[model samples]
Target: MMMKELHYSGSFTVNKPPSDVVNFITDLPRAIICIPNIINYEVLSKDKARVRFRVDLGNEVPIAELRRVTTDAHIELVSASGNEIRYKVDGRAAGSTISISLVIKVEGVNNGSRINWDATANLGRLLQMIGRFVNIDSLVKSISEDTIKGFIGCLSK
Candidate 1:
C-alpha cells in the first residue's frame, strides 16, 4: 500500500510581536487547547504532549462506521529558533498513523507579525488507500484552520 502525504503552506498576520507569536506557537500544551474537537490533551513536559481529537470525515462515501477517526496524538516541539519553530505530531487514528509535522516562521511587520505556517501529514497505508476514494481537502483545511486557531488564541492572550 502506498502512503499518502499532504503538504500545505500559508501566511497570515497577527496583531502581536514576532517574539510573542513564536513563544505561543512553541507552547504545545496551550496550543492544543485551541484545536477544535479536542477530546483529550495533556502536557507531558515542556516539549511534549498527549492529545486526542475527533475528526469527522464526512458521511462516509464508501462506509458508514469508519467515517470518524478518534485520534490519539503525541505532540512535540522538536526544534525552535528566534523566528522559526518546528514541531511534530505522531498520531494514530482509525488504525492508521496520521503523523504530521509543522514549521512556523514569524517575522516582524508594521506593528504586528507576519506568520507563515507550513505543514505536512504522512498518512499510513490504510488511510492512503482510503484517501484515493475520499476528498482529502477537508482534512487538509481542518488542519490549517486548527493551526490558525492556535495562533489566534495566542494573540488574544
Candidate 2:
C-alpha cells in the first residue's frame, strides 16, 4: 500500500516580538486553549503530550452514532531554536497511523514578527481512502492559520 502525503506551508505576521511569539506558541498550556474543538490535552512529560480532539459529524450522523472520533496523538517537541520550533506527532486517527512533522519559524519583522510554517502528514492507505472525503488540505490550512492567529491574539495583550 502506498502512503499518501499531504503538505501545507504559509506565512503570517504577528503583532509581537519573535521571542514572545515563539515562546507563546511553544508553551502548550497557553497555546492549546486557542484551538477549537480540542477536547483536552494530557501532558505526559515536558516534551510529550496526548491531545484529544472532537470532530463534528454534522446532522447526518445521529447523536449516538459516532458523533465524536477522538484521535489520541503522542506529540513531542523535537526542538526549539532561536528561529524555529520543530515537533513530531504520531497517532491513530480513523484506524490509520498518521505521522506529522511540523516546523514553525519566527523572525523579527519591523517591530513585530513574521511566522513561516509548514507541515507534512503521512497518511496510511486507510486514511487515503477516507481522505478523499476528509478535505485534509483545507483542514490543515485552517488549523495552521488559526493557530498562528490564536497564539498572536492571545499574547498581544
Candidate 3:
C-alpha cells in the first residue's frame, strides 16, 4: 500500500475575542459538537475523543460502497495555549490508515478574532487504489474544505 498526502490552510474571522475563541476551541466537548457529518462521538478525556463520521466520496470512486464510507478517528488535543490550539489525529476508513496533524491560531482583530488553520492528512491504501482512476486528492480536499467551513460557521453562531 502507498500513501498520499493532502494539505489545507485557510483563515476566517468572527465577531468574537481571541480568548473566547481559544476557550471554545479548548473546550473540546463544546467545540467538537459543531463539526458536521458526525455520526457519533465520545469524549475520552479532557483532550481526547473518538469520533465516527460518514464521508461522501461522491461519484469519484466508481463503486457505490466506496462512494460513501464511514470512518472512525481518535483525536487528541496536543496543545492549547494563549491563542493557539493543536491536534493530532489517527483513523481508519475503507481498510486504510489515515494520519493527520492540525493547528489553529487565533489573533485578535478589530474587536473580533481571526482563526488561521492548517492541516495535513496522510492517506494510505484506499487512496492509492482510487487514485489510479480518479482525482482523489481533489475530492478529499473539497470535502475537507466544506467540513471546515461548516465547523467555522457553527462557531460563528
Candidate 4:
C-alpha cells in the first residue's frame, strides 16, 4: 500500500482577538458547515462527530460519510506559550481511512491576530488511487482554503 501524506499551511489576519478566532474554528458543527462538500454534521457524543457529505471532482461526485474522534471541538493549549492549539481528527470516508493532525497558532499583531493554521492528512490506499487520477490534493486544498475564507468572512460580519 502506498502511503500518501499532505500538508497545508496558511495564515490569515483577523480583526479580533486570538480567543475569538480560536473559539470560532473550534466549533465543530459550525466549522464543518463552512466546508464546501459537507451536507451536515452532528455531534454523536462528547468526543465524536459524524458528517455526511459529497465531494465533487469535476464529473465525479463521491458521496462520503465521516466520523471524527476528538476530545472536544474546542482548542486546547498544550503549553504556557498560549500560541498553539493542538488537535487530532480521525475518520473514514470514500472507502478509506482518514487521519488529520492540526495545529493552529495565533499571534497578536498590530492590526489583529495573525491566525496560522497547519494541517496534515494521511490518505489510505484506496483514496490515494483516486487522488492520483483526479488531483485530489489540489481539489481538497481549494475546498479547505475556501472554507477558511468563508469562516473569516462570517467572523468579520
Candidate 5:
C-alpha cells in the first residue's frame, strides 16, 4: 500500500538566549502542556516518553499514543549558529500507524533567539485514502504551529 507523507515548517522569535530556548524546548513536561490535543504524557525513562493525544481532525478527537525517541540537545556558541533538538515519534491513531520526525533549532537573534521547527509524518494507507479529499499537509501545519506556540508560551512563563 502506498503511504501518505506530510511535512511542516515554522519559525518564530523568542525573547531568550539560545541556551534558555534549548532548555525550555527540551523539557518534555513543559513542552507537552502546550499540545492542545495532548491528554497526558507518561515518562517511560529519562530519554523516552509516551504521549496520549486527542487529535482534532475536524471530525472528532482521535485518541493516539506516541512514543518519542529524543536526541541530546546541542548548543552552539556562535550567535548565528543554532541549537538543535531532534526526535522521532511513532504512534497509532485513527485506525492508522503514524511515524514522525521533528527537529527544532534555536538560533540567537538580535535581542533573543529564533526558533525553527520542522516535522515530517508518514501516515498509513487508510489516511492516504482520506487525504486524497482533504489537505493533510495543511492540517499537519496547523498542528505544528499550535504545538510550537505552546512551546513558546511555556518558555514565556
Candidate 6:
C-alpha cells in the first residue's frame, strides 16, 4: 500500500514540574493508560509496549467497514533526556499500514510545566481512499490532538 504523511503539533500546561512529567511519561505502564480508546496494553520492557486501540470514525464515513476499526501498534521509546522524549509506533489500521513518530518536550513554568508535542503519521492506501469521501486529515489531527490533551490531563490529576 501507498503511504501519506500527516503532521500535527500542540502544547498544553500541567500542574506538575518537568521532572514529574518526564518520569510519568517514561514509565511505560503508567503513561500508556492515558491514550484514548486504548483497549489493552502490555509492557514489553522499560521502553517498549504492545498497544491495541479503536478509532471512531463518527458519522462522516458512509462505509460501514471503515466506520470503526481496531488496530494494534508496537510502541517504543526512541530517546529521552532531561525534559524531552521521543517515541515510534508502527501498526496496521483498516487494512493499511500506519507508522507514527512522536516527540514531546516539557518546560518548567511558574507552578507547573508546559508540554509541547508533535507527531507524524504515515498512513496507507485505505486512508487515502477514505480521504476521498471525508476530511481524513482533520479527523486524524483531531484524534492526535485529543490523545495528547487526554494524556496531559490524566497526568495532571
TM-scores, all models, native as reference: 0.91, 0.83, 0.92, 0.75, 0.80, 0.95
In the order shown, what is each candidate's alpha-carbon RMSD? Answer: 1.6, 2.8, 1.5, 5.4, 6.7, 1.3
Writing each residue's lDDT as its tens digit, candidate 5 over 1-157 gives 7676777788999889889988766766555557666666776554466777765556422322222211122111122224888777777755677888888888899989998878788887656655665567776777678777777787777
- Report the C-alpha displacement of residue 25, candidate 2, in angstroms: 2.1
lDDT by residue (1-157, candidate 1, tens digit) is 6576788888889888888888888877767788878898889999999998887877754777668878899999999978989999899987888788999889999999998889888888767766766767676777678758765876777
Question: How many collisions between residues are there in candidate 3?
Answer: 0
lDDT of candidates 1 onward, in order = 0.82, 0.75, 0.84, 0.65, 0.67, 0.89
Estimate, for each residue in 1-157, the C-alpha lDDT of model 3 and write its tens digit. Answer: 4467788888888888889888888888887787778999999998999999888877856887888888899989999877889989899989988898999999999999998989999988876787776777777777767767776776778
Count of backbone clashes, every candidate in sequence: 0, 0, 0, 0, 0, 0
User: Cα miss at 132, model 1 (Å)?
Assistant: 3.3
Candidate 6, position 68, lDDT: 92
lDDT of 1 at 127: 72
Q: Write the per-residue lDDT of candidate 2 for residues 38-148, one digit (tens) a residue.
A: 778888777788887765533443334443556767888889988899989898866778898999898999989998888998976655664455565666667667766
TM-score of 5: 0.80
Better of 5 and 6 by lDDT: 6
Error of 4 at 127 (Å): 1.5
lDDT string, candidate 6, 59-124, tens digits: 788899889989999999999988889999999999988899999999999999999998999988
Question: How many residue pairs in model 5 have overlapping backbones?
Answer: 0
Instruction: Give candidate 4's whole-model lDDT.
Output: 0.65
Q: How accurate is candidate 3 locally (lDDT)?
A: 0.84
Candidate 1: stretches off by over 4 Å: none
